[model samples]
Target chain A: MVEPLRHVTPFWPAFWRGFRALMPLWLGIIPFAVAYAVTARAAGLGVGETQLMSLTVFAGASQFAAAGLFAGGASAWGIVATTFLLNARHVLYGLSLARQVPLTRPERVLAAQFLTDEAYGVTVVHGAREPGGLSFGFLLGAELSLYAVWNAATFAGALAGAVLPDPAALGVGVVFPLAFLGLLVPLLVDRKAVIVALASGLGAWGLSRVLPGGLVVLLAGVGGALLGAVLVTRRGEA
Target chain B: MSVPLVTLLMWLVTYPARLLGLSLGRLKLPPFWLAFLRFVPVSVFAALIVPDVLGSPEWPRRLVGCAVGVGLMWRTRNLALGILGGFGAYWLARLAGL
Candidate 1:
């Protein structure tokens, strides 16, 4: 028999449960984090600066873009602008999850610090499955684990820089896309989802041709969401 | 500007953007808007993966890896196995000179 939903699970178990849930995602993140470290080092960032960026900034794509631009002698303002643009998607993630994960103001700020693509993905899955509503403990656990792994991997890669062979040659580049695909395929539950996903993919690809980095993704996401909203309303009416 | 200053600027712009939505938690969104937000994850992931998959230097290997991943997830309903299946497949394909 199914047990009644508890208003709260014990903190420790919920934390560990969140940690374990994200272990699979860690597989992909491990390599990606290492690659970022290596690339940052290669791009002329000092060890201290690279580690600091990983520790503080914590956004992957923006970190990479910033490092590349820095290497190319792009102005600091340009780098900042690009990074800001790339990370704009996080607002969407934060918005989607805000109401679901109930937390005090301070707790929300703390949780927002660890919000990444992987954490948000795991949290969404957890929110949908957990009958007891959003578990702040679970979110903390997952975010902390990813955070720990990412930093550790980055430090390891920085220390091992120049010795490591090209990540692309070893197929490490594919890990991220496949990881995302792993998360995505499960969510394509209906015709509406499939259509929205396809349209978003095509829209992003087309936009990438003319748009600056990150803007393509932002625009495509908005377009896709609008399409999804329309489809949902039509389905409801039907 | 110094590296430290650059890093600080990056953090300033980036961090606040992440936190912006959280501050608006109390504002009730319309159902249509919420439904649209529900699709954001799917859209975001799709946007992330499609470009890389299509533009991969080793398309055959990446394609096979993705297939292995999806197939594993479908069968086991397990995220870890799916990641491992895809990661392992990509490496195997590279080793096989694909």
Candidate 2:
């Protein structure tokens, strides 16, 4: 093979570019991953199970929700229900990314595997400038780096699980809620979103008094989103 | 269900939803639906976070942690800062028996 300018190792620039793009976000992601593993351990997930979920699901919020629900002894169906809603937005990410970057069928499959919120967001910004930003190489790089970092963090946190003393005494009890709190605040983008959050958050608190906790989350999510949609429509054309 | 089963179930739901998105990307859904979907993350996150905060035995501590977290994250827009700051506040509060 003829060597070209700047082609020594033969790695695609876009791939490394995507990896670098995602590297910065991992600083925010590590604690969340660690918290997940610690919470999972507290929730009675074996180390194997915790690693397996991170390995498979890869979505952070829903994994935390599932761990909380598992600690609360929610049913399997409840876990599935929450996971579905939490991840339903993945479809939108795929749609948006596909619109931005024309991906082949195989590319679609692989990209979907790595199409996390962070990966999607970073790639979107790059896609605007770099032709290869949202390409498969980019996604592979960004997502794989995320995947590796997340799993490694989970493992480290799992070890911390054994090391950290009783959950309540060390104030570890707040980690789960704190983790979700960090995620929630960022999503409050506008008045409509804020209202939806308030409505749903209050709904969850109230429903927790009577309903199962898992069910409350599901109901609040659907009800709040519906309310937001109605408000949007009433205001004007979407 | 067992751990693997639950994980499999989540995967079953997630992958298909994403695949459906790619196929349906060609056809734009109604604008109202799009707006609705956009709000789903906030709604879902609030639902997940609030009940956990309100239902805790150490709610006062949890709320303090949450308030600081929300404030810092909203102000700084830095996730790590928010988490660590809130966590530090929580640990201090817990130690002081708050």
Candidate 3:
């Protein structure tokens, strides 16, 4: 009995570490948040509405894609579908993570609401280190900090959007893609990973124009994974 | 769309998606898929960031920012530094009218 309580005591500290670890990451998010505002505003979302979207949706990539689609004259359903497809990866995250932390039906429902990239990263890293050792406080702390930083940057971005000149004209649009590329470049640590990343990026780039919907993104992801499997199997045989 | 309404809709929709992820399903996610899931953050971040960085007019300015970001990440291996450095450099370059 006492052992269980003792095991839980370090959870708050773990959460704090996770939160502190996240602060620097938020800096990169500022531009993305600002871009979201520019697009959201162009999409006919009011300043307040844009803020709400950031606060609520909280998935930066999905929001940007959705806003871009909206600005491009996509209907509400189309925007929603785009959001779902862009975010289908989250489903994969939840599925992989479910085995580690077996949440009750209600807790699973609640936890789903806050499953951002930051949360997923923290959960996986920490969960791996101390499997079954993460306390609710730890998860909450990491997630809440991410929530605050994300929403705050978004609010700032929307405010900037209401007054600033077109971000596209000023070349702020380039910042978004560069930031993403910088991230992707680091993760290609192996031949297989590199192949997957390149294939996916290139496939998506080419297919985005011709493929209806985000079939390109889907294809890239699937293609990369299949390529990885084949590579690993060949290596195993050797 | 109203802000609160968007928030409400998110709460309504995202929860179910999360729930669906957890419920035992027929989806036979393989080991490779599981490994791929680990990289989703990197993929998602790249997918989101690449278009804007390469899409802008002042490529030089954004390139400097990218250089700074890479340097920061190499030095510290801290994701936060990389992201922050990149954003800061870009903002500073823009403010300088570069």
Candidate 4:
């Protein structure tokens, strides 16, 4: 019965589905990438270096941090240290997604290059819906589209330079939070998920007032996940 | 100190964390750990977003955009439309000088 459905939908179809699934996320991604480009350029990075940073570093928050530090006349080592501290959440993301999508070392290495918060969110949501687990084709499709959009937006912003106006002034900065709200709505399917999400959100916001950098998010997420696991185990035993 | 060297160092510090879990994929995690991992996607996203929604500049406009976004997603369950609605609301608020 399911055989025909499986045969009809091949690897390419899954890949395309992944691409299309990420289309909505472009709302936030476009503005953020453009902001990074404009900020990097304004911070005295040449066009080549600005583009290179987007292409290689690929982490949005860290890129913004690095650009700000550079513009402030911080030392190279200072910029690197600050950016590294801001990106430590990626380790948590990688750990969460590692088992969900099994792949060989080489493929994993390649995929790691494209693992942004947005990519991971979309991949895991899609994975949960499909019984067969996460596919490499789907991951590739989603990541590649995000990567392409980010790089292109960066280039456009860099080329436009100061003429582009501030993305924030135009209300573009709201797109990220709005887009995330959209993503979060669909994931709240049960009591446990809601508790975990709410706890994590509140914890992060509270900790951000006192702590520095990305550690707030990482610690909050870990705490929420641990709480969720215990709740699930208790429910199961009941 | 050079731009290229700095870029290389940035990549070195960042990419390792992204790749570490994949390299350790062969190790089997306990069931409790796996259950915990399942909640991570939502937790991570919530952690990323809530701060911005609560603390963004131009509080009134951002609040309106967020309300519209959540309302649209709740009513329609369409991600693109919800985002577009939020973007439109934000632009409207800005245009109104809010």
Backbone atom clashes (below 3 Å) for every candidate? 0, 0, 12, 0
**Which has the higher lDDT value, candidate number 2 or candidate number 3?**
2
What's the TM-score of each model vs. the native? 0.94, 0.69, 0.73, 0.91
Answer with 3 or 4, whichever has the higher DockQ: 4
Candidate 2 global CA lDDT score: 0.76
Off by more than 4 A, model 4: A1-10, A129-132, B93-98
Candidate 1 residue spans exceeding 4 A from truth = A1-6, B95-97
Error of 4 at A235 (Å): 3.7
**Winner of 1 and 2 under TM-score:** 1
lDDT of 4 by residue, B36-57 (tens): 8788877877887877767566
Query: What is residue A221's positional error in candidate 1, in angstroms?
Result: 1.3
Worst 10 residues of 4 chain A by lDDT: A1-10
Chain A TM-scores, per candidate, are: 0.93, 0.67, 0.75, 0.90
The global Cα lDDT (0 to 1) of model 3 is 0.62
Instruction: Order candidates by TM-score, high to low.
Output: 1, 4, 3, 2
lDDT string, candidate 1, A62-116, tens digits:
8888888888899999999998899899899888878777666887888888888
Ranked candidates, highest DockQ first: 1, 4, 2, 3
Tell me how far the alpha carbon of residue A27 in candidate 3 is from the true structure, in angstroms, after superposition: 1.1
Q: What C-alpha lDDT values do all the predictions have?
A: 0.84, 0.76, 0.62, 0.81
lDDT (Cα, tens digit) per residue for candidate 2, span B18-85: 77776666566787776676566677668877887788888888888878977988899776677778
Residue A85, candidate 2: C-alpha displacement in angstroms = 7.5
TM-score of chain B of each: 0.90, 0.75, 0.59, 0.83
| Candidate scoring better on DockQ of 2 and 4 | 4
